[model samples]
Target chain A: MKKLIFIFVLLIFSFSYAYQFYGIPYLQQVNDFSLINQDGKKIKFSDFKGKYLLVFFGYTYCPDVCPTSMLRISDVLDELGDYKKYVKVLFISVDPERDTPKALKKFISFYDKTGKYIVGLTGKPEDIKKVAKQFRAFYQKVPVKNKEVGYLVDHSAYIYLVDPKGIIRMIYRPDNDDPKRIAEDIKQIIKMFGTGE
Target chain B: MKKFIIFLLTGFIFLAYGNEIIIKDPWIRAVPPSSKNTALFMTIVNKSDKQDTLISVKTDIAKIVMIHKTVEENGIMKMKHVDSLSIPPHSEVKLKPGGLHIMIMGLKRPIKEGEEVKINLFFKNSGNIEILAPVLRR
Candidate 1:
C-alpha cells in the first residue's frame, strides 16, 4: 500500500509540472485602465479587445534590457508572419516623468519605423503605479552617483500575453523566451480562443 | 651613430614586449533620432600572461560613458555600474546584450545604423586603445 501511494504521488506531481503553454501559464482577467500612447492619445485596455496584447513594462532610458526586450518582441512579431495582424505590442514606460509622449514616440519608432505595430504608453506616475499593480509589475527609481545620467529605473521585464478577451493567459521572460516559441504559443492560444473577434 | 643604433634597438624591444590585448566585433547599439542613450557590446581577449583591467571608456558621441552590468534579481532587471572589468590572462570577456555593456548617455547627436563611432578604452596595464565601432541594431 505504501508503494502504491508513493507511485500515485509521483504521477500527480509530474502531471502538475507539465504545462501546456511554452510560457508560464497565468490565467486571469486583467483589470482595465487608461494610459496615454506615444501618439498622445488616451488608450484604454478595452481598446485592444479584439487582438492579442503583448504587454511589457519598461522605461525609455533603459539601454540594455529594454532595447533587448523590444528587439525580441519585434522578432516574435516577425515569426508570427500573417498572424501578426491579430497581435499588438505595448511598451509601457515605468518612468513617466522622463518618458513623455514625444520621447516615447521617437524611441518606439526606432523599432517600428511605420509606428503601426508597437505602441509606447506613458501617463501620470500614480496612474502608472495603479496599472503596474494590476499586473503585479514592480519598478523603482534608484539614484546613481553620476550627475549626467541622473537616475535609473529598475523594473520587471516580463512580457505578458493577454488573450483577445482581456484575460491574461501567459507570461514570458524577455531574456529567456525564444521568439519562435512565443509565436507558436500565440498561435496555439489563438486556435483555442478563436481570437474573440 | 651610437645613439641612433640604441634608439632602434629600444624600438625593437618595445615592439616585442607590447600589450597583447585584442578587441573583436565591437559595436554600438543604434538609437532613434531623438533618443539620448545607447549601449556598446564587444569581446575583449587578453593574450598576454598578465591580467589587465579595463579602467575607463571615452567617446565623443555621448557626454557620459560608463561600464554597466545588467543583473536580474527576483525577476527584476537592474543596471549596476561597474568601476572596472578585469580580463584574465589568456581569456576573453564578453560585453553583450543582457550582460556586461558600456552605457552611453546624453548623446550629442543621434547614432544611426551603418555609421561608425570612435571610442577610446583605457586599460590599467595595456594603456589606451582606440576602436571604431559600427552602429547596429543588434
Candidate 2:
C-alpha cells in the first residue's frame, strides 16, 4: 500500500511538468563569448555552467525602454520566489564608450540594488559587435543636432533566453513584459528540464 | 416660457466653463510584442486663470500610469517617478520625448504603429480631461 501511494504522487507530478516555457525553437547552438564584469574580472559565458540566462543589449542612455524592462526582469526574478537559484540575467552593454565598468555598476544598481546575482559587462565596440552579430543584433548611432557628445542608439530590443549548456534555447521578448507570466513560463522550463522547480 | 428660459441659461453657463486643459497631441511609442513597457507624451495647455496641477493620469491600456521626469545630471539621463507637475495660469506645458513625459508600465498588450491609446488626465482644479494618444514609430 505504501509503494502504491508513492507511485500515484509521482504520476501526478510528471503530468503537471510536461509543458516547457522556453527552449531553442530552431535548434541553433548558443554562441560563446569572453567578457568582463563591473569589477573588471574576466569571465566567459561558459562559466555559467548550470543555469539559464536572460540576455539584453542596450545602452544606459535609453531613457524609457531599457530601465523599464530591467525593472520587470528583476520583478520576474522576485516572482520566481525560490527558483532564482536556477536562472541568471546577463546585462551586456552595446554602448562600450560610455558604459564603462563604473558606469555599468551604477546603472545596474538602480534596478538590482541588492546585486546578489546580476552581471554587467562593457567592452570595445569591435568585441561588442562580434558578440552582437553572433546573437543577431543590429546597432547604430542616431545623431542629435547641436549635441557635442553622446547620441541616441538604435538597436534590437529582443531579450534572449539561453539554456544551461550555454546553447541557444529560446528567446524571451520584452514585448509583453508580464513578469508573473514570464516567471511562470521560466518555472515551467526548469521543471521540464528535470530541475523540479 | 419662464422654465424654458431658465433651462437655456443653465446650458449656456456650462458651455462657457472652458477652464479645462486641452491635451493637443498624445502618444505611446511602440515596442516589440514581448515588452511590458511603453512611454506616453502629450502637450497640455491650461486655458483658465487659476493655477492647476496634473493630479493623476489614467489609461485603459496600461496597468499603472506614472508621471516621470528625465533629469540630466553630469551629462547622464536618469528616470524617476514624479508626483506632479505644476501648470501656472494660462501656460502651455509640453511633455515630449527626451524630456518630461509619462511612463506607462504593465501594458495590457503590445501596441502597434498607428494605433491610438485613450488617456484620461485628472487635474486638481479642472476635474477630468481626455485625450487620444497615437502610437509613434521610432
Candidate 3:
C-alpha cells in the first residue's frame, strides 16, 4: 500500500508540470501557396521542404505591430544563433496592392538583418485571403479618408511553429518579452522526447 | 519572508499602498503628412496600496481625448473605445502600439512637423505626469 501511494503521488506531480512545456499546438497548419518573395522569385511554401516555420502575417504600412513583432522575431533568431540551422521564418503580406514583389523585398531587409532572409510573399488579395484562412489567421483593413491610400491592417498575432513535415507543432501567442525565449521554446519542442540529457 | 510580506501588505491599507501606477515608455508614432490622429503608449506601474485610475489625458495638440485598444478579430485590426483604465498595486499595465493606446482625436490645428506635443496625463490619485512627444514625420 505504501509503494502504490508513492507511485500515485509521483504520477500526479509529473502530469501537472510536464504538460505546459512548449508552445501551443494548433488544429491545422498552412501548406501549399505560391507567393512572390522579396527577390521577386515566385516561390511556394513547399519549397521550404524540411525546416521549422515561424509564420506571421502583416503589411509594410503597419505602424507598430509588424515592426515590433518582426524585430522581436529577429531577436529570437539572433538568440537562436546556430540553432537557426533548424529554423526558417516566413512572413506573408496581407496588403498585396502596395506591397509589390519589390516592396516586400525592401521591407524585410529593413527589419531582419541576418540575411538568412525572411521570405516576404504577396499575391492577389483573394489568394492572400485563402492562405491566411487555411492557417486560421485574420486580417482587415481600417481605411481612413485619403489617408495616404493606406490605413491600418489588423491580423492575428500567432507565431506558428511547424515541424519538419510542415505540420504545426505549436503556436505562440502575442508576447513581447525576449526573442531568445522563443528560440528556446522552439528548441524545446524539437528536443521533445529526445535526449536533452 | 512570505509571511512577512503578507503582514506588511495588510498593514498599509489606506491613503496609498505601492509606489507604482505610473505609465512608462509612453509614445506615439510620428504622424503622416496629411494625418491628424496620433497614438500614445506607456506602461502603468502601480506600486502604491490604493487602486488608481487613469481618468483623462490632456495635450496641447488635440481637441478631443479618448482611450482605445486595438484588437484582432478574424484577422482584422479594430480600434475601439476603452473606459477608465485601472492600475493595481504591485502590477504594471503597458500601453503599447497594438494594445492599449491613447487616441488624440481632432487636432486643434496642424501639428507642424519637427514640433512637439506636450501631453499631460491625469490619474485618479490626482498625480500628474507630463511628457513631451516629438512630432516628426517618421
Provide DockQ values for all models, in the order shown. 0.75, 0.06, 0.13
lDDT of 2 by residue, A9-56 (tens): 454356446754442232345567888787888788888868877788
DockQ ranking of the models = 1, 3, 2
Candidate 3: misplaced stretches above 4 Å? Answer: A1-19, A27-29, A175-178, A192-197, B1-24, B28-39, B43-68, B72-77, B81-94, B102-130, B133-138
lDDT of 3 by residue, A1-197 (tens): 67754664464346438645345544354578887887878888888867777888877666456656777777777787667777788889988897887776666765565557477888889989998888788887776444433355667777787766666656777653357667877776656522211
Better by TM-score, candidate 2 or 1: 1
Best by TM-score: 1
Error of 2 at A14 (Å): 13
Cα lDDT of model 3 by residue, B1-138, tens digit? 999988877766544443345556556555433333566777878887667788888887776667778776643456666878887766788887667888775565656555657898888784787877665432
What is candidate 2's local distance difference test score?
A: 0.70
Off by over 4 Å in 2: A1-26, A146-149, A195-197, B1-19, B22-138
- Residue B118 Cα positional deviation in candidate 1, in Å, after optimal superposition: 0.4
C-alpha lDDT (0 to 100) for residue A72 of candidate 1: 82
* By TM-score: ranked, best first: 1, 3, 2
